[model samples]
Target: MRTVGHLLSRPVAIGTALVLVMLIAGFVGWRLTGGGEYVAPTPSAAPTVRADTVAGRDSLEELVAGVRDGAKPEGKGAAAVATRNADAIGIEGLSARYVAESGNVDEDGSWTADVDMSWRAPGDPTLSEELKVGFDGDGEITGFSADEGTRMPLWLSGPVEVRRTGSTLVVVQASAEQADRYAELAASAVKQVRTVIGWDRPRLVLEVPASGLDSALGAQPSTYSSVAAVTATVDGSSTAGSPLHVWVNQDVIGDLDSPGAQVVITHEAVHAATAAPTNPHRPMWLVEGYADYVALRDTTLPLSKTAGQILAQVREDGPPKHLPGKAEFNTRSEHFGAEYEAAWLACVVLAEAGGQEALVDLYEQTGRGVPLERALRASFGFGVDELTARWRTHLSDSAR
Candidate 1:
C-alpha cells in the first residue's frame, strides 16, 4: 500500500521542513531453516546449534494476568519483586489500560511477544502499535520495544503522561506536568488549523517524547534525523483513513520559546487538518507552503528572520528561477531550511495575487482530483509558470 510521510525537521528554533516522507519499497525477505528431527551433516565432527526448547505456538494470556484499568505493570523477571516497589521495567508509568487485541507469541517463547496493542486517552481516538512485549512467567510484562531499527512510540516505549484537551490529546514521555503544557500548545494548534480550513477531525493527537530523536515513531532514525515534528498516520502507513497524529521532536522544539513552539505545532496541525494534500500527485510547495502560510500568518516575525535562509540565497544568487521541487526538500540539503522558507514565500505570493480564498480554492480543487494547471488557472487566472514568475518577483521584494 502507498503511504505518505510528512517531515518538519528543524535546527534549534526555525522551520526547515521536508514534509514529504516517501517510504522506499525494496526490502528483501529472508528465512532461516535449521533445528529439525534430523541432525546437520556439515557439523557432524563439530558442535551443532540446536533449540533447547522446541518451538511451539503460545498465547500470552496465560502469562500476563489481572491487568486492571488505569494501572501500571508492577513486577517482572526477577528483580521487580525483589526491590523497593520499583517498576519491573527500567522505565516507569506504563499504562495498563491498553486492550490487547491479540496475545500472540513467537515460536521460541523468549522474552518478546508480538501483540497488537492499542491505547487511547480519554475522549481521544485510539493509536495502535505492533510492539514486542517482554514477559515473564509471573504474570508481568518487563518492557515494550519495536523491531530492530524501527522507532518506538511513546505509549509503548515507557511511562507516558496523557493529557486530553477538547478533541485533542498530548501523550508525552516527559513529566506529567509537561503534558499539560503540550496540551495547551495542542489547543492553540487546533485553533490555528480551524482558522485555516475548519477542523473536522474527530481527534488530534500530539506526541512529545522526551528523547525526541530516539523516539520519532517512524522507520529509520536517519529519516527523521532533523525533523522537529511530523504530522502523519499513527502507524506510518499512507493507507486512506489511517489515524493522524502530530509528533514533535522535543530535542528540536525545546530550543524554541513558547510562541515559537506554538508556531511549530500549528504548522504540523495544518497537516493534520488537511490530511496533507491526501493525493500524492499534488505539488509539495502547495501542500507545505499552505501549512507554513497558516503557521506564519499571525506571527510578528519579519521577512528577514522568517525567510532569512531563502533571503540570503536570493541576495547571493538572486531569487530562485523556479519553485522548490520535491527534491529540494531534502532534510540533508545544504539549504534545507531555506527551501521551506522559499516555498512559504511562494504560497505568500499566491495569497497576494489572488485572495486567501482563491489560494485555498486552488489547493482544495487540486486535492479533489483536479489538475494543478486547471485549478490554478480557474482560481488565479495563471499557470505554474506564471505563479513561479510572480513568486520570484515576490522573493526579491521580500528579500529587500
Candidate 2:
C-alpha cells in the first residue's frame, strides 16, 4: 500500500480554535494510498520431495488436510495453530477455510505447507491467498510470514471485530462497539460520495487497526507513519475482480472528533468510489482535490476553518505557480496539508467556474485518457495555465 496511490489525510485530527487548521495539521503526515496495479507476493517454490509421514508418526496429509475446517485440535498441530490464528483475529462471524495445496517435511521433523487460506466476515466477501506456514519437530506450529507486496489482513495478523452497515463493511482491531462506530462512519462516507458520484455504487470497505506496525499491510513503517487511511489493492496482487480497499491507521485516525472523522472517511470514500488510484496518468491535484472537495462539500465550516493552510500560504507566499504534483506530495509527506488544501481549492475553482457537473465531467474525461488541457477547454472553456491563473487568484482572494 505504501507505493500505491495513497489518498486522504487527517483521520485522527483535532486541535486549536480553528478546526480546519488543526485538521490540516493532522493531515500533515500522509503517504498517499491507492494505485492502478500491484505486484503479487512471490510464493515460495513448493518442494517436490514429500513425505506422507513426519518422523514416521503423524501423517503429514492428515495434519495438512485438517486445516480445511480451520478447527483447533485437542492439543497441538498445524491445523490447530491456524485455527488459533483465526480465533485470535476476533472478528465476529469470521471463518477460515484452508486448502493444503503443497508441503514438505524437513530433516528435523519439521514441515512446511502452502495453504490456500480463505477467510470471510459477516457482510464482506471472502479473501483467499496462499501463505506458507510451518510446524516444528513436536507437532507445534513454528512460524508464518508474508514477504513484501502481500496484504496481511487482520484475520491473518491479530484480533479484530467486524460490523456491517448497508453496503459498507468495517473491520476494527478493537471492540465490537468500535466496529459499529466505524460502520456508521462508512455509511456516512457512502452517503456523501453518493451525493455527487451517483453514477456508480460505492463499495466501502475499511480496516481500522487500533495498534499494529504501519507495515502490517505490507508497507514500510516510515512510509505512512502519519497517513489517516489509504485506498489500495486488497491483496497486493491486482485483479479485475478484486479492485481496492481502504485502510485506516487507527493511531492516526483516532484523534478526530465526529465531524473530522466523517470528513476523513468520506474523503477516502470518494477515492474508493472514483477508483482514483487505478489511473496513474491523471493529475494528482484533480484526484486528491476532488476527494477533498466532496468531503468538504456539505460542511458549514467557513473557508478560514477548512482552508486555513493554503489561505495562509497565499497570504505569506502569494499563490503557487502551478498545481500540486506527485513530487509535492512525496517530498512534503510530513507537512503536505497545505498542498491538499490547495488541491481542494483548485477543484473548488472548477466547480465554481463550470458547476459541479462540469467538474465531474472534467475529472471523468481526464481519467479516460483525455488530456487535461483538452478536458479543461471542453468542460471549463480554459486550459491548464488559465485554470492555474484563476486558481492563483482564487487563493489570493480566499486569503483575504
Q: Which candidate number maximizes TM-score? A: 1
Candidate 1: tens digits of C-alpha lDDT, residues 135-154: 54333455666775555656
Per-residue lDDT of candidate 2, residues 169-285 (tens digit): 776778777788898999988988888987365678887866643555776646666677888766565443456678887777788888888888999998878777777657998
10 residues in a row with least lDDT, candidate 2: 2-11
Q: Candidate 1's C-alpha lDDT?
A: 0.66
Top candidate on lDDT is: 2
Positional deviation of residue 148's Cα in model 2 after best superposition, in angstroms: 5.2
Q: Give the Å shift of residue 137 in candidate 2.
A: 6.5
TM-score of each: 0.72, 0.70
